[model samples]
Target: MLAEVQADELVSVDDLIPDQAAEFVSQLSTVEPLPPDDDEMIEDETSENLVEDDSDRSRPVRENGSIYFGECRLLNWTTTAKGGMKADLAILDCPADAVHPFKGLLCGKQNGQRLRVWFGELADTDVPMQVNYQGEALLLRWSDDSVNGMNTQVMLDDGPDGVKGTHPFTGLPIGRVEGHRMKMAVWAINDDESVIDPRKVKRKVPFYQKPETTQAHLLSRRPRFISYVKRHERRLTRGQEIRADITIAPDEYIAEALYAILGITSRSELGDENAVGREARRRWSSLVGEYFDDFYGRR
Candidate 1:
């Protein structure tokens, strides 16, 4: 009864080996030993899979491609090798669910750098163009050659993966571009208080504003402060005054600066803006005040 129960319970080859069944025991000696080294076997497998055609060596098997799913702000036009042209893009907003690891590639961790979009022969023209790779699409409108920046709403394609392409400049394997839509805005305030929209304007409208005296004062008083202000200057409205004192509450520039100085890289790290960012700004203001006090004492 015990043997019958054991036989019924056995469900796999492992159980049968331990049971020492007559068929398994008889077949053990006939089982051939594996080769000592598998290098020859591996070589044989590789040889069978490799393409034998020599003509295919002249060109890449797959073309290079990349999909950037974020708020890409056109900083300025740049000249490339052989007099080619490319737009410098600053990735403003990358989603948390972004498929690619684009943190450092989008912008440098320390000194920020813009991503380049090579226009090749099409640089001089003011035209709307489309760049599609691996289902990801970029609708670019080059109004004209000017410092006036532009922004657009982009949705990363989450479609079926396509043949990988090598980045022409970087020589890195470009994977599928996948992400969601992000908010983007770039416009200049006109003299008549009307906004110069990039979509409506056929030609690139130059973004110009009279330099505020307060801005110069802030620069003279605190040079380091300019870096922080420039990063978040988009938050300011037309003709918004930038205060010299850093004690302003709910200031985006101050909050961004505090995050940088404190080494808080991500928005997620800034838990509770009032608790983390606001408090840090307060402490920073106090520190700056003390520094000025010490300077006056030395004099």
Candidate 2:
């Protein structure tokens, strides 16, 4: 019976001899038991430790060095050393919660030459106007949504009625505004020529009606305006370039989000497969990563 059991035979206990059954039971008791697995327990403890460490430490936070300005108004236009007109702008609004290392006005100039002749008229009118300059047609519109009453926006290859037009400069297909759209407001000049008191004129009013003199001051909070101008002036005197560190990576979701944010439907419309497209994609990725990190990093 023991030999048959060792050969894998299905033998009943009743068929086994008493001494054989006793020997089988004794052998079973002598066999060693398998060790318990500790891998699962170790893994659980490691995960718990990781969660505790994460809870104890805060994620590193850094600022996107780019300077952003909202409710911007053109405070003044002055002649630069190269005879080009330099526009001083007041940043009336910004991300209030953000840490702005560069808090001030932004000066803009083009090609060491005076701005296109129509800019003066546009500034003076402060109303929606279409003007043809440098073989390109541009539509300018004013709004008062930013502050009490101050804002200006420009659209290219489109009229005041929001109708698309053929590109005046390219003669290629035109779809929407190209390059950076300027959102700006012109400074309001006082109408009364005899009254020189700057205190009497409010800075929040739009410049629709022509004033007696061309001289004008920025229409924003006095303190903020002064501080902005001073900061820019100091930077200019010191000859320092404010460096903005931007980082970007190639990501499909980031690209889609950027397209929506930029109000564009097709990536091809943005000159895909070209240098312009590559740069746009890079910038969009950087912008998304900087402003909307949660969305950018979402799985």
Local distance difference test, candidate 1: 0.29
* Candidate 2 residue pairs that clash: none
Instruction: List clash counts for every candidate, in order.
Output: 3, 0
- RMSD for each of the candidates: 26.6, 37.3
lDDT of each: 0.29, 0.26
Model 1, position 267, has a per-residue lDDT of: 38
TM-score on alpha carbons, each prediction: 0.16, 0.16
Model 2 segments beyond 4 Å from truth? 1-70, 80-83, 99-182, 185-299
Q: What is the lDDT of residue 83 in candidate 1?
A: 24
